[model samples]
Target: MELSVVTGCLAGAISQDPEDVIQGGDVLNKQASASMEGFLQANAPPETEVLGGPCEESSWIRPPVDFLKCNWDASIDGRSKKMGMGLVFRDSSGGFRAAAISNIPYITDPEIAESIAARWVVSMCAKLGFQSVVFERDALVVVNSLLSPSPCWRICGGIVEDTRRMLHQFNSWTVKHARRSANQVAYFLAKHALSLVQDIVWRGECPSFL
Candidate 1:
């Protein structure tokens, strides 16, 4: 099913001509990993005030100067068997930079879906040549996996590996845990993605729903 779904997205790309818009694949992946490895590895943010987990800071936080913050979230519609992923990027001053929503029709596992969402936004930022980035997600599992230098061998291992590999492209990057409240925009965009037939990208400002 995964093969067929990927093949279909690939076939559809021929007409859409994604090549004229952005590039993809292992070459870019390797380049990103190599560049990222040249810098000191970053760790996840210190645990929030809540002690054992992320705090209920229901608000967005700005990244350091010269860095961009990209928040991502994922949702699954069990009835429709669709997974929606949303990403929003903002500059250090907290101004909206870009946002994207991708509807994936086959993902069922929540962890795997979150991993896919992380990879999607990371790849998007990489393609856009973003060097310093901070990725925030409500899924603590994903954040923890990214912080670990050792590879994981779970069902979602492949996606996790891809995500860690991509972090190498950034001169400096942070994978931190944010409460769902703080991730509202991306969460809404993710839920909205359930209705989209194809991926959507917005620049400078978010859609009216935001």
Candidate 2:
């Protein structure tokens, strides 16, 4: 399957024809992974920590689920820099809900941040124990890919799937595209995450500080 995907990418890039696109089922389809890898690598944000290490859940501190909004952000590690992703969730009244910020190993490009953000949202949402909530993000590619009919990129597809699993936890939920200005909370959180040199700290009034 990877071979097929890579072929597809090779076809698209090497084509001498101006009006050319990778034909459906073309052997070039195999190149998708290779192309996507390079694309992801080239487009990835700057460098950051490689997450997915063992994480600890703090029962002491807690997020206010009923706070009215939720936001999530993640950074994609580029070769030497990191690209960031931010998401905000707001209730019908448009107040605070929940917010998250995370960083993952560098890949290559910005678009990959979408999937990382998507997966991070799911993981964070689950941890947050949000029963019913709306999801929002600044990455159109992530949102559009989720909404798109074409099968999402298989690797990124897992992030979408994980997001779907988290969605099941919400009695009511929606994913919406939001402008950067509207997603300030999550963006701050993501950017703030970059400040930590040895540990992660949460600001605002989280009960966990208790």
Candidate 3:
């Protein structure tokens, strides 16, 4: 908020440097006044208007009974042009079933990386013999594309087709999107891939970071 006010003031002034416009005393005084106002507003009676927190954070939800839930994520490093895909499988009761991290070389596009993560998770599920599963991801574009297959884009077409084939292999399967907050475990694993020289897999339980 202070930054917004300072920016607004700076926009109307001739000085382009923040140091010249953001006076210490003015900022301090304004901040104190704003804090007091916020405090009173929050502590005000129920009838009074006060700002409240944002909507509740999205959390991981368990899959249906007898089904497995797979949350996958991909991390791409721009500098090295490397991509890492991470996926964690959990039972309907939310117990960890398995997790894997794959570090791929020379992938710069985030969309393709996300698609690979999806395809990789499906392949993992097939090897694990999970007949019924739901694949969850934070990438809405990939999820939408998977739900509605199109031949318009040639990029990752083979990977997309491979994922479709794997999906059909399962008796019951689904692909859906979840907020990044709900997919923290997979995100952590994707970031963790950067430190590994080869793919890593964990069975029955996950690492301490989870």
Candidate 4:
């Protein structure tokens, strides 16, 4: 907000060498402000408006910040009859932001596990009141179907549709594919759920490593 004010003032200035003035101590903040606004304005369409919070120009950035990492995963083991899901949200710095887990009895395929994980992600974003969300999954089939969704994939159809509906409430959100190596934290969170002997519900902390 302060940036917006200064940027406008600098752009209207009556001074010669405004760039030089900007480089000097008195108006460096104004230059930085204009530059940042320029950055914000670059990505948004000119027609967008701000009803609250940030204007569309600056809204693409999600906080819990760029240093924050957000992703999810599920474990599907058809032969072993185990299914589990997890979400791990962290600041880019790798600190634990938030984590959740669920164990389901419908253990017939890895597809089911992945679908449930996607559903959980949308639900979590809504529950957290996140205005901007970015979800990552390692499963290409799942991510592709989500981006250009299919009406099939019936194994978790109801949950999939529910997640899609929840997604419409956000101002900005993205879902994409990530490889296993890039998705290790969420992968491990789901893996940890499979390691547990007891069924558990998501609670406040990072639940035990079991």
TM-score of each: 0.73, 0.53, 0.70, 0.58
Candidate 1 lDDT by residue in tens digits, 1-210: 111111112111111211132222455334423432331132333331111223234578887898888888887776566677768899988888877767776676777777777788888888767777878887777778877778789988998888777777677777788777788777766765555545666666444445
In order, candidate lDDTs are 0.65, 0.42, 0.62, 0.50
Task: Indicate the residue-level lDDT of 69 in model 2.
Answer: 42
Query: For all candidates, what are the clash counts?
Result: 1, 47, 0, 5
lDDT of 4 by residue, 108-135 (tens): 4555666766876777666655555566
**True-vs-predicted CA distance for residue 204, candidate 4, Å:** 8.7
**Count of clashing pairs, candidate 2:** 47
Show where candidate 3 strays beyond 4 Å. 1-57
RMSD of 1: 12.1
- What tens-digit string does per-residue lDDT give for candidate 3 at 1-210? 000000111011112111222222444334423533442354112332212112222789888898888888887666555666678899988898877766666666766776777777877788767877878877777777666645526588878877766677777767777778888878766765543454556666444445
TM-score of 1: 0.73
As for lDDT, the candidate ahead, 3 or 4, is 3
Q: What's the CA error at residue 93 for candidate 3, in Å?
A: 1.2
Most accurate candidate by TM-score: 1
Better of 1 and 3 by TM-score: 1
